[model samples]
Target chain A: MEIYELTVHELLEKLDKKEITKEEILASYQNRINEKEKDVQAFVTITEQEAKEEIKQKANNPSKLAGIPIGIKDNICTKGVKTTCASKMLENFVAPYDATVMEKINEAGMVSFGKLNMDEFAMGGSTEHSYFKKTKNPWNLNKVPGGSSGGSAAAVAAGMVPWALGSDTGGSIRQPASFCGIVGLKPTYGLVSRFGLVAFASSLDQIGTLTKDVKDSALLLNVIAGHDEKDSTSADREKEDYTKALKNDVKGLKIGVPKEYFGDGINTEVKEAIEKVIEKYRQLGATVEECSLDVADYALATYYIIACAEASSNLGRFDGIRYGYRTKNYENLKDIYRNSRSEGFGAEVKRRIILGTYVLSSGYYDAYYKKAQQVRTLVKNEYAKNFAKYDVILTPTASNVAFDIGSKINDPLEMYLADLCTVPVNIAGLPGISVPCGLNSEGMPIGFQLIGKPFAESTILNAAYTYEQNTDFRKNKPEFKN
Target chain B: MQVSKEEILHIAKLANLNLKEEEVDTYMGHLEEILNFANIVNKAPIDGLEETIGVNEAYNVFRKDEIIESLNRDELLQNAPEAQEGMFKIPKVIN
Candidate 1:
């Protein structure tokens, strides 16, 4: 049997039935990586030997994901492993400790196959910002997979791994998952610990999972979620088995469809596909209601400002005097810091840092930065109010399917617009998931998003899984099977 | 809709970036478009409502202040680009 075609549950069943050993599964994936990695380029670093050893040890564990191979985004720190965030700034830097989520993953007995590629420091919507190499979409080799979490999404879509852990800030996880035709979930802000996940925008950042199906996403979330002493933002709440809520019943569930989402700029094909998905949900004992978000158009703008502001502060520690890249020849202290940052950071990162700094500067603080925060309250409140009436909000994961690589590199604002629908969820601190709905005329995958109330991920997963079961879109696999 | 080169340089210095002259025009164009688009936020009706900086409304996230041992010299210096005599060494600041 093709190992990549099996769901996480099916693979576990095979192992329980003595059909395969952890070593055999690891070997099969390693062989697949060797055969397909040259074309896919989904991973930044592959820890083949480490993966085999981990799986062998985990073979004795009782966890469901004990022997499953999962990919991790480069931004999440793994102790003694290089976590570069696909940027040149930390190319040689090795983390001294694993992020809280990574620690939990290890405890759960999941084998991390490798660190996947991503946009440099999760800045751009397209993976082209990566200083290492561009990650091609598994579906269409010439097209992009999606940004920030593009590599994680593409790897799962390409069958390189059954699941991957990705950080979502401003729709990074959901948008890429939509493009790659997989299920990606961005849990509520404090649902997952971010202690060791390299901070992008601390307030908006969340660790989520990308899987071939919704069940795997829920299972992975169940394993890596909960409060940790390391992260102050982690909520002190009880953990629930998210898988228990995936019965695919949406009776009397209120689904909101924002009017602004269906407006201009959305491709006709994507709109049609989403409409069909909505129709299916309606047919399956649910109600779809048309709602309006007053600040929908401003989501990208507010997201950029607030995210960059937080990033500028979070990245301040990476000076030459501290950890990360440093210039070899520096005459003075100022030169060391300046030259190190100039030589270390990429163009996109530098651009945002400059923008963030300017906005937070004394003169512009009141005009731009503070104003954005004040408005952010409105956006969050809007979601809070809407959640009172609806169980979830449904929208297209992206305005369009994956575009060709480098298409929006020159147009940064246009690229930022790609996360328009997904950013609002981040701003509101709500959980959102993207599930593959259909393929456009170009045969590229299109994802539909489900936004749920705070910590209401199970509702969203159940809805998406129910719709997925009713649809035939996920049956076709990419032609590049190893 | 256009941002001046002087403004760009000013923001850059504040943001701790040493940008090349050629990059200013690119940032200028992008920032202008973004700020113009951001005007939409001004129209949002959020006058009396309290501003939300974080999600879930769980507040009072203060930690108890207490003395804790700092990182050892070696561990601290491990992250430095250049350290000497158990401290970070840098070039002279004053002329």
Candidate 2:
């Protein structure tokens, strides 16, 4: 069997059984990276030495995912590695410390594949905003693999790695996974430690996993999901075995179909694909009910305001005088900041920074920023009410299949709407997953999302797994090969 | 349509970012549109509801306030692009 074709569980078992040496697994991944990376453009940097050393150490004692290669989103800080959030501002910047999640990944003995490309400062929905390069969808080189977490999603989709980690603040992980035709999980806010993630929108940002299948995603979540002292927002709860919840049956699961999620904006092909999945669920003894998350209609408006505001504040630390990139032709302090930021940030990053600052401005705070926060409470309450009644909420992961890279770049608002279905979960701090439901007329994968109650990731995983087992969607891998 | 070039400059300063003269006009246009759409959030009936800021509403992360040793000056300056004698090097501030 091809070593790289092995899933997380299979790779771990092989490592434990000594069927494949750590060096051999590393060589196989490197070979795949060498052959497929230029076409996929999934990674910003590939860490050959670090991965080799990690695997060597793990070869001594095996762990859950020991010796498995995983791609990391560029936004998460890895000690001594360049953690550029796909921005020129931090182009040469190296983090001095490992994020709390990175520390956990190290302890679990997984090999790092390197930093994957993302939207600059995690601002846009399409990966085109990345300063370095746009990551292509593995399904078709011309189309995009969702934004921000595009690289992570594409890497897994193209079979470069068995699994990868991506951060989701307003659907960065799920939307990409949808476009790439893989499984992505955005855990309940604070489910995974955010101590090391470069803050895009503080309250909305949460680390998640993107994998070839739901089982790998669950296994990845088990290793990375937990509380950390470094992140004050990290939930202080006992960790549970997420992998154990994978095999549960979804018979009689109450799935809610939010009326707003199925409305006019969704692509016709995508809608049909999701409806077919709903019918399948209904046939499997699960009850599907049409419900309304009333506040969801205003999700994009509320999300952008709050996210930009928080992003503006969180990104304040990247002054040129510090560790990151600084302008060379600056004469004074003000010039330094002005020129550094002006030259460093890409269009999308600058757009968000301006929007964020506008919302937080003195006179307009009440009308824009504060009201968005107030509306956020309403969105949260709406989810709470729905979750009390239904076991899970189902919707299309994105409004459409992956479009061409340049198709939405000229229209930022149009690009922002692409995340409509996934953003509400971020605002409400709920756990959501995107699994391959079906393919559209163009043959691109369309994902259906499952949102669960806070900390109810197991329910979402179980529901998705049951749907996956019944459908032939998993058999449809992108034609891209090594 | 509520945004203006002067307001854009002010907000940029607050964010410690500098915008180009040509770019400010474009940014002003886009920011205005987004803020106009954000106005819809004001109509949300959140009356009598407490504003939720953080998830789970946990706050006041007060530790025992124990003293931690600082890294040596050399170590601290290791990552700094420019430094001089335990101080970050910079152009003269007062112009």
Candidate 3:
């Protein structure tokens, strides 16, 4: 196998045995990135030279996961790197400091492969909304890679990088990972510091890992997850080496299959893939059974309300003064604010901002925003009740396989359906991981998500790892166009 | 449930965004659909539930009131669209 095709854990093992050097690993990925990046279009910026220099500088580092190549979503701040969040507003904005995750990655000796693309401000489900370019699914040239973390999923799936960091607001990480046939883990909210992540929805946004396998997700989590005083909401807890949770045992573990997630709108093929996954868990001595999670019905609506509200508030800072794009035709301050925002933000972003404003407006605030917050409480309480019985809940990562690009972008409601199966976890502040289960009839990858209790990333990762060890799906890789 | 062009423009005004003539219709149609979809929240059985402003458990996080080295002003100002004397220069607000 080419060095770039190996999982992060596999590469680390190779690095340990002197079979490959860090410089050699970086060179391999750079070569693969050169070959596949055009078709994948997974990156907003590619830092091959910077990565090569870093490998040389950190050759003697003692961290276990050091020397692995990883990419960052454009939203995550890296010192002097362009962190655009794939919006024209921040097209030229360079972060002067590193995000806490970037600091952790650097301190752990991982090489930075530069930034990936996303929806404008992470306001859409498809990466097509990116101001730069739409990332294609590595599995199929004509299909979307999914978003707003499409670039992260596509790059890792294409093996351009061993793994990459992605932030999820409403299924941004898991949906793309499912579409691209890779592992994506969105840790519990506040488990990872969001100090420098360009905030989309502060309450729901979380930094996660996209990798070729489950162990890499755990390994990357070990580096990125933990408390940061910079992020006041960051979880204050003891750091656990997530790699130690990689046991291939799910015996007696309880896995709840939310039947609500399978019914209505989910494709038959995706449903069967998840069923087979459940059966696999059952056969491995795990107690698996169907259960009702009625919260599934309202998650998307609640998500849009809360996410857009938070987005409108969080995005108010970009007024063309401090940084980002400025309107050349502005004479007064009001002119600058309106024109800069209008020109800098894309259509989806504008729609969200308007919707947010409408919801939080004087007459409608109690009905829309307040109602959604109350429903958010219900959603969290429902998930809490479920977790009280089940060790982890299982669901299809997305309702369907990756659809063709441009199919749903024009229809906003149809586009929102892309996140139906995955948004509930974020609504409840739970850790969820999407792992490749099997292929659909069209040869597209289908994934199942394991949702765990808050601060219980180890549980979900262990369950996903157990499932991965038993399934041959992990052996598959998408064929990049020659 | 019904939004007119005046309402959308009003919302755009509140959001500090300017919509082009055509984008107004596009956003209006999409916003109505999204709001209709989001109206489902009003029907949810949350009668007795308390609102959750945020999921993170941390509240009123206080930090030590001590001086710490901060990001360089020159470096930060380098990103400003208009900067003068290490400050973000804007169109005069107080006329």
Candidate 4:
């Protein structure tokens, strides 16, 4: 196999045996990007020159992932890299210092070679909302690799990068990973530090890993997860080595399948794919049962209210005063703030900012924002109840396989429905991983998510790891060409 | 719940976004639909439930007030659209 096609574990094994050099590994991926980037368009900046220089400097570093390349989602701050969140407002914004996650990855000797694209401000489910470019699904060019982490997922699926960092707010990372036939793991809310992540919704936003398989997800998570004084919401727990969770045994493990997920909008093919996995788990001595999670009905609504309200408040800082785009036609301070934002943000982002503003507006707070917070408590309580009976809960990552790029973009409400399956986890602040389950009739990939209790990333990772070992799904990698 | 043009413009003003003449109606429609959908949270039986701002429940996360070297001053202004000798220059506010 080509070096670019190898997983993080495989490449590390080869490097330890002295069978491959870091230069060869870099050259192989560089070649892949050259051949496939035009079709994939998964990056805002391909840091090839920087990666070449870092390979020599980081040589013989002690970390297990030394000299490996990883793509960073555009929203994560990387010092000196243009960390545009696919929005024109910050098109020229260069992060002055590394985010906490970036600092750890740098310390681990991983080369961040690209800034993956996403929805403008990480607000949309499809990357078409990006002000820069739309990343096409490597599985089929006409279809969108789900977003707002489409570029990260596409880059990994197309083999442009071995694994990439993605941020999930309302299903961004997992949806894209599922659509592109890759593994994406959103660590529990506080598990990973969020100091440098461009805040969308402070409560729900998390930095996660998008990789080819479950072990790669585990490896990347091990590097980025930890507490930090920089992020107030960071979990102050003991450090964990997530790779130790890759046990191939699920005997006596209790799994819950929430029936609400398979209701009306879920595609029959996607449901069948998850059912087959449930049967496989049952055969493997795991107990599987249908569970009720009626709170699923209000999750999407609650998610939007809390997410948008926080986003509106968080985004208020960008007013063409300190940094970011400025309007040339401004006559006064208000004009500069108004016109710069109006022109800089895309339509979807504008819609969200407005939605958020209204939700938090004077007369509507009790009806929307405050009520959503109360419902959020209920969502958490429901998950806590289910987690008590089940070690992990299973659901389809996305209701349907990736649709055509423009198919759902025109209708905002329809676009929000794409996140129906994955948004509940973010609402409850739990760890959820999407691993490829099977392919649909149209040949697009279907993903099944395994969700674990808060700070219990190991439980879901182990369950996913077990399922991957028994199924040939990991072998079904997407092949992309110019 | 049909949204009025005044209400849309009111929120837009609050958000500090200047809407184009043609885009206002479109945004108003989309915002209303989303808000109506989000209105479902009102029906939730949340009277007995306490608010969950975040899952960690760790409020007042305080650290020592010791000073450490901060980020470079020059690097922070590198991306500013308009920068002066030591600060970001913006449109005049004072009359």
Candidate 5:
């Protein structure tokens, strides 16, 4: 196998044995990027110079991620690197300092290969909302690689990078990973620091990983998951070596299959694929049973209100004052703020901001924003009730496989439904992972998610790893050759 | 649930945005649909439920009030669209 195609674990073995050098692996990935990037358009900026510098100044006492090349989602701040959140507002914005996650990754010796693409400010489910370019699914160029981590998933699926970082607000990472046929994990909300992540919905957003398989997800998580003093929301708990969780055993594990996720809107093929996963788990000695989360039906409504409200507040800082794009013909300070934002933001972003402002506006706060917060509590309580009984909850990562570009972009409500299954996990601030389950007749991948209790990433990782090891799903890679 | 163009314009003003004349109609439709969908939250059985302000139980992450070195002013101003003497320059507010 090509060095670029190897998982982080496999590459590390080769590196330790002196069978391959960091330069060779970097070159192999660079070659893959050259071969496939035109077709995929998975990155906003490819940091080849930085990667080369990293390989040259290799650390003597190498960490597990030492010399490994990984793509960072555009929203994560990397000092001196262009950290555009796929938005024109910050097209020229170079981060002044590394985010907490970037600091951790740098300390672990991981090379920042590039800045992956996403929805503008991590807003949309399909990368079509990006101000730059749309990232096509590597599985089929005609389809989307789900967003706002679409570029991260596409890059990993296309073998352009071994693994990449993705941020999830409302199903961004796992949904795209499901569409692209890879492993994506949205860690527990407080599991990873969000100090440098450009805030979408501060309460719901999290930094995660998209990789070839479950073990790679665990490997990356081990490096990035920990409490940081910089982010107040970070959990002040003991950290675990997530790599040790890859035991590939699910015997006696209690898994709850949420029925709400399998309701009418889910595609038949996707439903059958998840059924197969449930059957496989049952066969592997797990106690699988149907469960109901009544509050899940309210997830979409709650998510939109809360996410938009927070987004509106978080994004208020980008008013052409401190940094980012500025309007040239502005006559006054208000004009500068108004015109710069109106011109810099894309349509979806604008829609969200307006919706958020409307929800939080006088006379409407109680009906929308406050109501959503109360519903959010019920959703959390429901998950907590289930987690008390089950080790993990299983569901399809998305309602269906990726749709054609422009198919649902015009229909905002339809686009929001794409996150029906995955959004509930984020709402509860739980760790969830999407692993490729099977392929549809159309040849697109179907994925099933395993969501664990808060800070119980190890449980879901074990379940996902067991399923991946027993099945040949991990062996299936998108045929990107054209 | 129908958001009028006037309301959209008002919301845009609140959001510090100046929507184009053409974009306003499209936004009105989009916002109406989103709000209609978001209205479902009102139907949720959330009686007596406390609002979840945040998922994390962590509160008041405190540290000693010690001074830490900050980012270099010159380096920080590198990405500013308009910078003057290590300060971000903006349009005049007081005329």
Candidate 6:
């Protein structure tokens, strides 16, 4: 098999046995990226030279990620590397410092492959909103790879990279992972530091991993998950070795299936796929039962209000004064601010900003913003109650498989509904993983999610790992040549 | 839920954005749809629930006031659209 097809664990085994050198693996991936990047369009920047240079420097203490070439979603700052969040606003903006995750990756001697593409500031469900280019699903070139971490998911699924870093606010990581047919984990908010992530929605944003299988997700999490003094919201707690949770045992585990997640909007094939996953878990000694989560009905509305409010405030930094794109001509200071932002931001971003400003405006605050916050509390309480009864909750990652590109881009509301199944977990600050369950009749991949309590990444990872070990889903890869 | 072009422009101004005349009508329809969807929050049974500012059990995280070296001023200004004397330059605000 080609080196590009190997997972991080498989590559590490080869490296430890001296069967392959780090340079060989990097070169193999570079060759694969060169061959398939045109078809997938999964990258905004390819740092082949930088990656080659970094692998030459041997590490003093090698970690599990040593010598692995990993792609970072463009929103994460990478010091001198250009960190554009798939927006023209920061097209030429190069960060002066690395994000906390990048710092950890650098210390572990992982080769930074390049910056991947996403929706502008992670504001959309499909990468069709990206100012640069839309990433196609590796499973079918005509379909979307999902977004705003579309490039990251497509890169991993296409075997262009072993694993990649992605950030999730409202299903950015999991949805794409589901569409791309891979394992994606959005750790509990505050579990990973958000110090240098280009803030879309500060309260809900989290850095996560999109990988070929569940084990790679845990290994990557081990390297990147920790508290940073720089990010105040970062949890000040002991870091767990996530890799230790991969025992492939699910005996006596209680998994809850929220009926609200499988309501009217879900596709028939997606429902069947999730049912098969539940039956497999039951056969493995897990007690899977259907449960009702009432607050889920209000989660999408709550997410829009809260996420957009935070986004409007956080994105105010790009006003043409300090950094990012500025207008060519402006009569006065106010003109510069207004013109730059209007010219810099795309349609979806501007729409969200306007909505946010309206909701937070004087008379509307109590009616919308405050009301959403109260509903958010209700959602959190519901998840807390469910966790107390079940070890993990199982749901479909998305309502359906990957849709054709441009199908839902025109209607923003239709696009927002794609996040229906995954947003509630983010609302409650819980960890969730999307693992490939089966494929639809269209041959597109379908994923089922396993959500765990706050700081219970180990629980969800164990459940996913057990299910993955018992099935051949993880072994499936897209045939790019076809 | 009924958003006029004037309200759309007003909201755009508040957001510090400039919209073209043609874009205003598009935004009006989109915003109206979004607001109608956002109305779902009002129907939620949140009559007596406490408002949550954040999901984490957060408190004021404090640290000792210690000086830490930051990025070089020149490196920071490298991406500025307009920079002069290590400072970002914009149109004169006070006239």
Select the stronger candidate by DockQ from 3 and 4: 3
Give a tens-digit lDDT track for model 5, residues A145-261.
999999999999999999999999989999999999999999999999999999999999999999999999998998889889888898888979888988888999999988877
Q: What is the TM-score of chain B in candidate 4?
A: 0.88
Pick the winner on DockQ between candidates 1 and 4: 4
Clashing residue pairs found in predicted model 3: none
Q: Once superposed on the true structure, which residue ranges of model 4 sit more than 4 Å away at CA? A: none
lDDT of 6 at B3: 86
User: Candidate 1 on A198-245: residue-level lDDT in tens?
Assistant: 989999999999988988888899998898867888888998999899
CAPRI grade of model 1: medium
lDDT by residue (A78-159, candidate 3, tens digit) is: 9988999999999999999999999999999988898998898887777999999989999998998889999999999998
Error of 4 at A212 (Å): 0.8
DockQ of each candidate's interface versus the true one? 0.59, 0.65, 0.87, 0.84, 0.84, 0.87
Chain A TM-score for candidate 2 is 0.97
Candidate 2, A1-482: lDDT as tens digits: 68876777777778679797767777888998888888999999899777887777787655656677888999999877899999898888777778888888888877788999999988877788999998999888899888879999999888887789999999999999999999999999988889879888889999999988888888889888988777888888988988788764788899999999878899999999989999999988899999988876577799998898898888777778867788897878888878878788888888898888888888888887777878888898898898888999999999999998798887787787777899989998999999998787777899999999999998899899888888889878787532
Give the DockQ of candidate 4: 0.84
Instruction: TM-score each candidate.
Output: 0.96, 0.96, 0.98, 0.98, 0.98, 0.99
DockQ of model 5 vs. true complex? 0.84
Candidate 5: lDDT of A227?
89
Candidate 5 chain A: worst 10 consecutive residues by lDDT? A58-67
Stretches off by above 4 angstroms in model 6 are: A59-61
lDDT of 6 by residue, A120-204 (tens): 9998887888999999999999899998899999999988888999999999999999999999999999999999999999889
Q: Which wins on DockQ, candidate 1 or candidate 2?
A: 2
Model 4 docking category? high
